[model samples]
Target: MKKILLFLLAISSPILSISQNSTTSQIDETFKAYTGWFVDAIFYEIPFSDTFQIPWVLIVLIGGAVFFTIYFKLINFTGFLTAIQVVRGKYEDIEKHGVDNLYGEDAIVEDILKANQEDELNVAGDQTPGGDNIETIRDESADGEVSHFQALTAALSATVGLGNIAGVAVALSIGGPGATFWMIVAGLLGMASKFAECTLGVKYRDVGADGTVYGGPMYYLTKGLKEKGAGGLGKVLAVLFAIFVVGGSFGGGNMFQANQAAAQFTKLFELTGENSGLYFGIVMAALVAVVIIGGIKRIASVTEKVVPFMAGIYVLAALVILFANFSLIDDAFGLIFEGAFSGLGIAGGLIGVMIQGIRRGAFSNEAGVGSAAIAHSAVRTKYPASEGIVALLEPFVDTVVICTMTALVIIITNFNGQFMEYGVEIKEGVELTAVAFDSVIPHFSIVLTIAVILFAFSTMISWSYYGMQGWKFLFGKGKITDLVYKVLFLLFVIVGASISLGAVIDFSDAMIFAMVVPNIIGVVMLSPIVKKELTKYMNAIKKKEIAIEEGAGDLNDQL
Candidate 1:
């Protein structure tokens, strides 16, 4: 603990000094001076004409989603019911136990089990000359840390936060209501991307000697590519992914969350003085440290309960407003559709609207960005594709459902055009959303404030696990290394709240999206493997269904 404190003090000394000496705007400007180039490079837009251009990263994200949707034959649409079933444990029997006669022989099953056992022992550094005594194949399904629902909620907590609230508001404000149309389209396509990468996360994951699971893009990019004879390239991509994920965890996941949550809490209560943010930061950091230190299983446990409650409250509120203004629903949607195609009165016309929508959707769900894979990779299931299918629901819930609700409320409330002007950029999106909600439901901003804090807390914890995995990948899984990372992460929560570093946050957002580069390349190349896994899982389900029908027939005959 002394070492941990020393580390924290060393890091915090300079940060606190800056906060005490510099104004928020000055600190922001200082950060921009150093990080502006990297931010500009990451978000650099390529122009198609004099007026229209898009970020290359967005193209990669959307393009990969399109390709995965095509390659998987639209698994996003077809697997929706199956995903629900998987989460509900309807197929738990098949996932936990082998389908009878599915592989046809014990020898084949033994070979597969032995290969996995050897890999696990190798990672744990306990493999002997002849290996330990052989175990039954049933244990293969018991390797992961969290159940399907837990994994789903854990990943959802990260992606479904401020983006669903503030981000959707921003997209609509800039691109007009038409942006909503493209956002939904992009979200639907993003489901396929989620399915593909998460499948790889499980297929190539490592199970430690302590039954702890280690997986994500870092593992798959290395192990999956090595299987395809691209070992060197795979290692390179994995390292880069690890680096980017760590930076993202610090900036976007930890700091950005704390910063936004503090901002909202202070604004709502009308708290005054410079110490308000600092006090909030300290308390928030303490709460986050408690949850994150328990690791993924603990994080999953909390998120499973928190994600649903927060999401339900926010969605329920939206539903209340929507139901109250039932007559405006049709008009709002009409604006969305017409704006999507015609780009009427919106900047950059149809293409601009599409870009704004797709960009926000991609950013909101992070479907193709690969961070979700880290969370989903911890799911307890023998079949990798089952978890992948479960992961697809993230984009559906985040972008298609929650973000849509947010956009609708903004549009419906703007009937008088008093709240906001169409096509004008809005910087304070969360405030805008709060105003829109409060216009319909009095004191709704208070509920929104609680929701924002919950969103930020959950996001920070989940991303702590993500960044930890990457930290372990680069620095080894030593106790001291783990403590160091955690201490730094907690300190970052304080720093994020105590100061304003807009450029730092932007740079982190770039780092998060930058992950899409290596991740998309790896997943696309390994998509054939995802296909094989999907086929294997589907075949098992079919066989299980047939056996159930046969048993029912036998029972009928006996009767």
Candidate 2:
């Protein structure tokens, strides 16, 4: 703790002592040469035509979402209602039974006999459990830290941020109204990817002796692949994923969030001069440090409250705007379809619009990115697929609902020619969103500003946990190592706040999108594993229900 404080003081001293201009300029230069080449390489785009170029990374993301959607037989659609039920704890007993009772006395006796047989075989130097049938026994007495609902919210807190507000605006500005249609389509498709990755997250997780859960793509890629006799490939992919995840934590999850929050806060206050962002960053960093130091359990507790409240406020505001312009809603839908299919004279034609929409939609919900899998892995459930089912709601809420709302408001606001022409460059994305809200509600800019900060805060804390998992994977998990990573993360928050968006946004975006490469590769390799887990869970539920019904029928017969 003392070293942590000293590190903070040392990094912050420059900000306090130097002029704001000097600080900003100095900080910007610090990461420029170091990160530029890496960012450019990862985000390199392949042009199909002059105006319809797509990033290779995005193709991986979109393709993964599409593959999972098809391979999973549109689980996103079929499981939508089931996902809500899971989050509502409707099937919690399924998890409890597996953990607590292990299917009651029959299962216990069977397990004991199996163990005795295995022991005898081992005594003869034969063997014990082998193949895919050997299950990792979980300690029902020591369950996970957070509930399914809490895990959902914790992951949601990270995703439902400026991406919904600012990213949607950017997509619209580039792709026109048509992008909205494709964006929704991509988000819906993304639900399958989320389900696949998260189910694997819980299936391949490691619970420490102290009951702490260690999971994410790192665990799944390594352990799941090793089981398939590809240990070397799995280790390589796991390391690559850890590297990208950590970079993403600093770039997209940390800096991008801080940068946007500072931009909104300073703009709202009409603060001028260099010191505005620097000071705001310091305060934001301090606040982030306080929460992250407590780790995921504490983070989950906070997000369960903040995610719902912030989402409700933002969604409620969007609802009001939509209701007010109820008559124009049909017209808005027309523009979205026409713009998507016809392109409405937009550059790159329909293809350009589709690319922009899909890109932004994927970016917004991050269904294929595999970050949410990390959060969902911590849920206290014996059935891994239950959390995966719950995860289907994330892209729906983040992209289909919240992002579409933002797009509608923007589209509606532009109907009067109050905003720039479609496909025109948007200078400030969030500010553009704020303008749409302000057109309806007086002084709503303040509300939007508050929402931005809260979004940034929640996202930072969640990302911190994600990055810490990666960090622990690379460096051995220890107290000093954790503290060091946390301190550096908080410092980067300040750096994010102080720097201009150009390099920071580019690097962060690249780092985040780069995560798709290794993550999807691993998920695709292990899709069969996730499918097996889902089948097992469904069968267990059926048997339990049948047994219950038979017991109830017997009771009625007796009565």
Candidate 3:
């Protein structure tokens, strides 16, 4: 504890000193290089300098999703019911049955026997349990630190944050309402991509002998691809992914969060003015820094509490706007369709709207960006495919459902002319959303402010995990190594808030899109293995392969 306090003091002192003094030209020059890249990528290049035309990366994202959706024969659709049952504990008896009333020593012997037998079958069947299988994690840490729900929540904590709130707003701003159509299409198709990547995430995970579990695209790209005879390429991709994941953690995951929060504050109370944003950013950075030091458990604990509360509150607010404008709901939707296919102008074509929808949707959910793979990698499942099934729901919840609600609110609120002229301009994304929400609930900006802060906080925590995983991959997995990377992350949050490095932000965006090139290669090459893993897990569930422990076993217990 003393060490942590000292560290915090060391970090915070620099911020206070810097703020108290006049700004340095050196700081400006340094800031220019970093933030400049970020802006260029997100704003100018995504649609290739146009009315939100599709980028190559997005095409790959959508194409890969569509291919896999068909290849899996719509596993996202057909397997939903089964996935629900599994998560709901319908297969609890499939693992351990007679152990509850067994003699103590005998139970241990029986468990050994069960493990030995399963190992033989697993090897013969070519089943790659990796680190995610329930047996894999449970046997390693019989009493794990997290519950299944907690693990799900931790994963949710990461997935369900900014991507839902501000990301959707950004998509609509650039891609327009037509993008909403493609966003849903991308979300549905993305189910297959999520399933595949997560399966690999579990398949390639590495657990320490101490029961510390590690998993993500880095492991899978390095290990899974190597096993499929792409050792050299895998190494290069793994390294590149590590670099980009670290970049992503800072930009899309953390600083953008602080930047947005700062904007919200400055906009609301005029509280921050210019200096207010920087100080506000420091507070956010500190909040993130404190929890991140505690690692996954701390992040999970906080997110489990924060995500549901924030989501429920935000969704309820959207509900009020929807019902309050009950009559306009239909008309609002009609406008969405009309704008979605506004083919009379701008290329006079169907292609324009199609491009807008797909680009906006893909950007919003991050389906093919491969970011979700980082979070899903840590799930407690023996079958790699199990997590894959769960992951498919991400895009559905994020873009399909949540983004739809935000759009509806914005469209419905426009009925009373709360916004300008009923069409969006380049500069009006946040304002558009703010006007819509404040229309119904006065002082609603307070709620929106809190929601944005929570969204930024949750996103930063989750992105920290993703970036750390990548850092460990490149710099060796050690505590000191992790700490070094984290300090840099915290520093970036403050820096992001203080400057206007739109270009650096753009560069980060490009890096995120660049990640798909290597990731998709690994997924496509090893798809057959994914299929095999899926089959073994399904068969085990079907056969009810229970561990008949001759000791204290509970078949009624959850998996």
Candidate 4:
């Protein structure tokens, strides 16, 4: 704790001095210098042809998604229904059979040894001679800070932010309606990737003696790979993943969300002052601090409620617009498909459209970026596969459902004005979306603005937790350490709101995609383990070793 405090003090001095005196242009320029170098280094694009270039990180992301989808034998399909059941707690009875039952009388002694052993070595291996014995106790009582549903919501909160509201609009503005089709395809394929990584997240997680969960690609890459005799590679990848995700937490997850939210609010309210975003950010940071200080439990509590509410409102509004423009639905679909396949004079032709869609989809749902795995790692479950199953629904909700809705609304409302023009650029993603909503209903932009703020708020809080986890991995975990990170994270919220979006957006995107590099490597190397866990889980269900509550799978029962 003392070490953490001294470290915090050392860092805070410079931050405090800068915040008190730096001009906005100076701050922006400083941010640009740092963000530009990072993005330039990590996001170098690979040319596939004269006119097309794809980021190497994106290729890794897409490749991993496709590979996992096939390698897992389409678990995204076979396990989709089962995942729904898991989130509904249909299989929660397995929690009753914890590690205590594995050993009759020496459960207490074994648990003590388990704790110590896990601390010293990797706890991810369920069958390694001493490794399997160590996690028995942690796995006994559904070992996690949040329920399956809460975990899903927390992760969803992070992914379902501006990307859905603004990113789809941006894609459509540049690539036209064709981008929507590719985005949906990416989302579907990405489900398998989400399932694979999240499964590994739970499999390799370390449950602290007090029931705190520490896990993600960092845990899986290092520990799971060590078991496979690639300890050196695993450690390197883990560190790289940790570094990238921490940057993402600051950029994409924190700054981008705040910037967009503040942009929308300022436009909606006609706020002219430059510091409006700063004040808005301070309020958001305060609210976020209140929830995040309580840790994942509080974060889960807020997101479980906020996600459903905000999503419900946005979806409801979209539904209203769709219903109002019911006649144009078919026309929207026609444009989407036509623009997707037929060259619409888009920059790089059909390929450019496809690239825009997939890129934005990746940015929106974040299936393979591995950030969601951190949130899912905290789910309470005995079988790691259960959380992985539940995670499949994230992309479905964020992209397949919500993003599709947003796209349809944009396409339907703007069908007549050459809105589907391939070469034109829309500078404000939220504005395009807002215009679509306002077209259907007068004054709907106000509601949309509020929803944006809520979305940003939920995203900020969730990412704060995600960033802090990575921060803890880098700097040892303690109250002081945690406080330092949280302060720094909240500070970014204000900085994000106050700064120009150009450099920040580019950096945030590169950082987010950079996570894909190491994350995909770990997920690919560790996929066989995920497969084994899936098979065991299925067999347990079939043999009735895992109990199921009657009617628990019913959607009505969950509600």
Alpha carbon deviation, residue 489, candidate 1 (Å): 0.3
lDDT of 3 by residue, 1-559 (tens): 4444554465345445444545455443444454555445534434444444556676777888888898888987987777677556555343223222222334354565566467566666756552333323333323233433445556656556555665556555544555567667877887788889878887788876645557777888889878878889999988888778877777777777788777777777776466776788789889998888876667767887987788788889999989888998888777667767773343414566566567666766676666777666666555667667777776777778877888788767765554544224345356567667888988787888888788778888878988888878876777777887788898888877776544445556676777787888778887898899888767765444343332334444422
Ranking of models by TM-score: 1, 2, 4, 3
| lDDT scores of the candidates, listed in order | 0.87, 0.83, 0.68, 0.82
Q: Is candidate 2 or candidate 4 better by TM-score?
A: 2
Point out the worst 10-residue segment of candidate 3 by lDDT: 95-104
Tens digits of per-residue lDDT for model 4, 151-251: 99999999997889888999988888899999998999999999999999999998887678888888999899999999999999988887777778888
Off by over 4 Å in 2: 1-30, 99-142, 551-559
Which RMSD values do the candidates have, in order?
A: 6.0, 7.8, 7.8, 7.2
Give the runs in model 4 whose Cα sits over 4 Å from its true position: 1-27, 95-140, 418-420, 545-559
Given candidate 1, what's the lDDT at residue 384? 96
lDDT of 2 by residue, 1-559 (tens): 5644564465446445433444445555554555778887887899877767888888899899999999888999998988887787666655754622434335443454455456555645634332111112233332566789989999999999998988898899989999999999989999999999999989888886555778999999999999999889999988888878887898789988998899889888899978789999999998998788877778898999999999999999999999999999999999999998998778888998998999899988998888999988888778888889899999999999999999999999899668757878686888888888999987899999999999999999999999999888887688988988898899889978877756656777787777888899999999988888888877866665666666622111111
lDDT (Cα) of model 1 = 0.87
For this target, which candidate reaches the highest lDDT against the unseen true structure? 1
